[model samples]
Target: MQSLFERIDRLNGKYNALVSLDRPRALQRAREADLAQARGQSWGPLHGVPITVKDSFRTAGLRTTAGYAPLRDSVPDRDADAVARLKNAGAIVIGKSNCAPLCSDLQTRNDIFGTTGNPWEAGRTAGGSSGGEAAAVALGLSPLGLGSDSGGSIRVPASYCGVYGFKPSIGKIARDGLIPPLGDPAREDSLTVVGAIARSVRDLALSYSILSGEPYGIDAAPQHAPRIAWTGEFPRQLMDDEVSSALEAAYRTLSDSGASVEKVEPPLDLHFLNFKYFMLNMYEFSPRESSPGLHKLFWLFESARSVFSGGIEANYKKLKADQREQVDLFDRFAQQFDCWALPATPTAAFHHQKSGRPIPIRHRGKSKRYSYWHATGGFAFLANFLGCPSVAIPIGRDRNGLPIGIQVVGRREQDTALLRTAAHIAERIGSTMPLAT
Candidate 1:
């Protein structure tokens, strides 16, 4: 059997998943882990496992660019809170994976390191923001990896690559070291979160447990089976045939498994949701005065548009406004059931170039526009905006053989139930196929 380091080295170039591989350090850690196991010393659940982190994470002594040119040489002096947690669990940090510029786009291509393609189909995109981590995990370059989801970053990649991704409720996991750390530091926001990407839903739960300091803490309660509201449409928006088909199949499987599944046409405004997300995301990038170039142009243009449309305040304010409204909506929505279900993305993995611009897509007698090209994450964003937990599990596949995933969303601080539901789905449908290393 090849060591994890060897496996990574053997497949790193094939997927372009990693921007920097810590070979010397990784080998050293593996050797230490081997020695510890030989002595019968134990660390934790993640002991001896090699993992990867998205480049946005601050890993001590390793370059973390967030895929920006100015930060290309930047290295953190300390690990982010999540990184420290995984390290404490005895997980080896092998390397940092690629990401979009400032982690703003849907595709993982930036001037600093170029692109990271899907392991399933080399010609297709792996999905963004967290695309690199998803690709790495899908290819078995790492069994588990950390990726942040500020609007479907983690789940999108996981869905596109046939892996598991989980975005826990805001504040359930510490946000102390997250990039652009939360303003309140302790308060959780709807748009930003640190999540995991893995080969199995069980792996996702395990990683979350270790990172959150709660072993086996994810609620796997059968009694908490939620009154699921399945929507093939994008909230109030449209959907694609591929997306609709995947969601329909997942609903059927869940219904077959004895879950209380129902279809509800809730009064939701998806176009506003898309615009709200664009406003907030653009505002996020505008403040980063670093990396002067097209990126600055990209942020400034969107930021200005948001300001002109909603008033020239700030992105944080716009996000807060949208979130406040979403919270109100959820407060009312919570009375009905435990959670909502939706397609993680309208379609499976596509060529990277096609995701470069926002466009309109149709599904189930609805036609709507996405404000940003990489707006496939529209459905998943609502859960994040409401500070709720959600897990993405592989459902089935499309005509082109791409993986389709279903998102199980729950109330804030209800991460345990969310993971449990996802695990249930995985157990029923069977987990997505694993990548060969």
Candidate 2:
């Protein structure tokens, strides 16, 4: 356990995945854990394990700035609910990981910690806002990471970094200690969820069990092989050739391995989902950011725009009807398959671009202009959009030798079963893609 601290000292400078250190406190706790184990006392499953939490989630004595400059000195008196659970199970909080400012951007960069580079390649982004957590886990800085997924924060990073990330249903974990407290936590966190990132499916399962207070069998077996409905095609978008081909290979490998893998057009309509995700996400967070000076005015303008774009309580309630319809459609469609699988992103990690600019598609003969949000979250939004549980598992590397992955989603609130199915697939397919290093 102490070696991890030494590793942090040796390697964190290059990856910049971890932003803070609780070395003394964490080492002390690890020693205690070792003593307890010697006496045959166990705190729980994660005893003696060291982990990191995204800076967005507060840790009692650790500074949590959420990668925003103004909150650089902010430290909480209590851990976020999920972080507390991990500690209760004997997981030591080694440090906090870097993230995009205020958790608003899709790539990990801030004036505070600089940036978290992809472990697989130099200059490529470790997809954010869970970028640091994913990269940290991938690089062995931590065995597991606590992150949040609202608009693909967890999925994108896991896909880009060749790790496993599980985003449970929204109500699974409380949102009491988010860096910037949610305006009306229960409601505002509707689309966001606490998630776990790890190097193996079992780690995700174990972390999920501890975080959500639900049992996730690390080697749980299915009565029968899971039936999967998967696709590599997205409506109105062209997947980069390498990614599309990697997914196709995964589909074939899974089919040959005995899981009932079938290709079909899912009920997922990226066109409708992308817009709804934008409006609903805006309604959830638009006015909550109160950065001062120009930033404050910018958010104020956003609030006004929300009002003009239908953000009143009445309009929110109206959107609920749309939400209900979409949920129903997914629920109905999901009845035929045990789970759904698809590409986590259109492509593997790309070189860092100007923070909010559009990135054109990379496939030959295709030049559709795509926003950073669309490129990364087009497929990922479906899980958060319908409030479903999804797991991102690295399948293999793309032509660039960067990792590519798939997101397997299951029914909302049925998290354990989804992990089991994903684990089963992971085992059969060997989730043995090469390490980033």
Candidate 3:
């Protein structure tokens, strides 16, 4: 544990993966754990294992800013429910990792903690808002990291950093005390979930079991071989050739392993679904009313107008209706297949850019640029919308040696089954790769 802290201290400056550390406390806990073991006291499964929690999770006495400058000094009186559960399992929280401001962006950068770089390439982004966690795990700074995913936060970073990330179905784990809080309408809707990022599928499974308070059960592989569905293309989205090829290779591996693989049309309109998702989040994040006085008066007027015109509420209802339709469609599709596979991202890690510009990709012999959100969230948002479990596992590398990942999605509330399936696929395809230096 001490050596891990020393390595973090040495490499943290270059990767900016961890923004804050509770080294003394973590070391003290480690010593106590050692002594307890020596005394024949049984410890938890994660006893003495060092881990980093995403800054968005509130940790008692540990500053959790969520990369927001105004909250730089904000320290919670209690750990987030998930964090507390992990602690109870004897994991020592070494530090808080960087995140997007308010956990809103796809890249880890904010006024409080500049930006986290990809462990494989310093000039590229690590992916966010769990980018820091992924980078830290990929660089061997931590064995496991706790992260949150509303859209693609956990999966994107895992894909970019060549690690394993598992987002369980919403409501599987308690959500109290996360930044943005339970009172926030966005969280009230349960779009975000506490998840884990790690170097192996087994770590994800263990962490999920500990954090969710559910025993990790094995899903017996089908005697007749499981059926897998996949889609390589998305509407109005451009996928890099390498990413597409890697996904295809993964499908071929499953097919070769006796799993029936078939190409299928996407069950929903991704563009419309993503658009509604963005608008819904925007409304949820927006202030309910302005400060008192003239601003408050104007806010009242706007609220009244919206109420009379059936504005925000109407839009929200329509979004929910559409979401239900898509979820229903997905459920029907899942009934016919054991898992759905898709590209984790349109491309591998791209160069870090502050402007939040559209990312360019060549498709069908033409060059096109997609907004960063759409590029990364295209395949990932569906999981959140449907409240389903998904796992991202590194498959292979691109020409530039950047890691490529494929996502395996399962039915809602079937997190353990999804993890088991992911582990099986990982073994079949040899998905485990050495971490980047």
Candidate 4:
């Protein structure tokens, strides 16, 4: 049988999922893993696996781009803290996958890297900002890959591409080297997180535990069936009929499996949600510490608007105002539920060229323009805004036969519990995709 790295290379042209390939290094690690096994020394859980990473991750000596030109040539001397942990657990980094510009957009295409196409439909988008990583795993380009989710970057792509992606409870996985590195004493804090995208929930959990370096402890043992909250109608609007039906079916599957499942409509503040999202995200380009390129971008915004109009000041005010609401939302959700479940994206993968643009997702014959075509990530942003964890599981296919996914989010630091629940749900729903023939 061909080694995993070889298999990925063989499929590269067809999928166009990977932006770079480190064949020699991956083969070197494979040989080392085989030798260690022969010596009766178990390398680690992911030993010998050829894993890919979103270019946003800082892999020592590898081209790390959050899919931007300015940072393309900027190689880090150290592996991202998460990357370091994965390596310690014996997973070899085979290559850096593509991502959005500055990891900013929802689609993976950017001026730096062309685009990442879907495995299921080559002409459709693979999903973004972690689209490339999801595409790789979905196409079996790699057994697993690591990605970051700021606003559904991980889950959206996985949902569209029919793969597994998890945004572990905030701070569960060390975020020292994730792109747009935040929390630098000299820098402002933004709400971005590093997570994993894989073909199976087991792979997602395994990668998280490896990165966390936490003793399995209480979570090592199998978990009992969970009480799940499945929301069919989105907090903002009713979802597409086909998409909503898939989610409802998934809930029924869990119920039949003996897990208690409820359909609840939680109140949400859409404006506050969007405000906080834009604020925290845009805060990354803070004038005090941003690079010249970012500064120039901000300058254009300032110049475009009238000085008397409170141009940049309005943006700051909205951000600060939303921060308060952001805190309230987090506190309220912690009290009411163990986790919230909903569609990860409204629809499946669309045509490849249409990846990044916002499209009208029709629900009950009423069309509404969402944030992005995959904007059903309204469920995902809740987890991110609150610094919570969420896992996306493939539910079934949409009308087009592309994958449909649902996300289950949990309280902060409940990473393992959420993973366990998703695993149980996937088992009940029979959602795992068959290997591509």
Error of 1 at 238 (Å): 2.7
What does candidate 1's lDDT look like per residue over 1-437, in tens digits? 14666777688787789998777887888888889999999878788788999998989998888887778898889999999999999898989999887777677888888888888788888888899999998888888899988888898888888888998877667755666541333333446888899888788888888777665854544766657777666444555777787677767887898877788765366667666765555544322443347557865775777766775455456567866887778767765766677778876776767444655555556665554443467676666566678888887777877888888787777676667766766777745685734
Candidate 4 lDDT, 189-291, residue by residue in tens: 4567788998888878878878887654334555445767767774544466678778778778788778778787664664457556654655543223334
TM per candidate comes to 0.87, 0.93, 0.92, 0.87
> Candidate 2, residues 1-437: lDDT per residue as tens digits?
77887877777888899999998999899899989999999999889899999999989989999988878899888898889889999899999999988777679999988989999885899999899999998888898999998889998999999999999987898766875453454355468888899988888888888888886665665787798999888778567878888888888889988889889885767788778777787667432453336455544665676677775565667667788789999999888888899888888898888776776676756666677777877788878879999999898887677888899999988888888888888886646555455
Q: Which ten residues in a row have the lowest lDDT in candidate 4?
A: 283-292
Per-residue CA lDDT of model 3 for 1-437, tens digit only, reads: 98998888788899999999998899999999999999988568988899999999999999988887778899889999989988899899999999988777788888877989999897899999999999999988999999999889999999999999999998898878887642546425647888999988889999999988888665455455556788888877678877888888878877888767889987678888787676555444422321126345644655776777588576567667877888898898898887888888888998888635888776666678878777777778878888899999899998988889989899998888888878777888746767677
- Which 10-residue span in candidate 3 carries the lowest summed lDDT? 283-292
Point out where model 1 deviates above 4 Å: 180-190, 219-221, 284-322, 354-375
Provide the overall lDDT of each model, using Cα atoms, as 2-decimal numbers.
0.76, 0.83, 0.83, 0.74
Off by over 4 Å in 4: 181-187, 217-224, 285-330, 354-356, 366-376
Error of 3 at 335 (Å): 0.5
Q: How far is candidate 1 from the true structure (C-alpha RMSD, Å)?
A: 3.9
Candidate with the greatest TM-score versus the true structure? 2
Q: After superposition, how far is residue 114 of candidate 2 from its true place, in Å?
A: 0.9
- Please give the lDDT score at residue 23 for candidate 4: 76
In Å, residue 133's CA in model 4 sits off its true spot by: 0.7
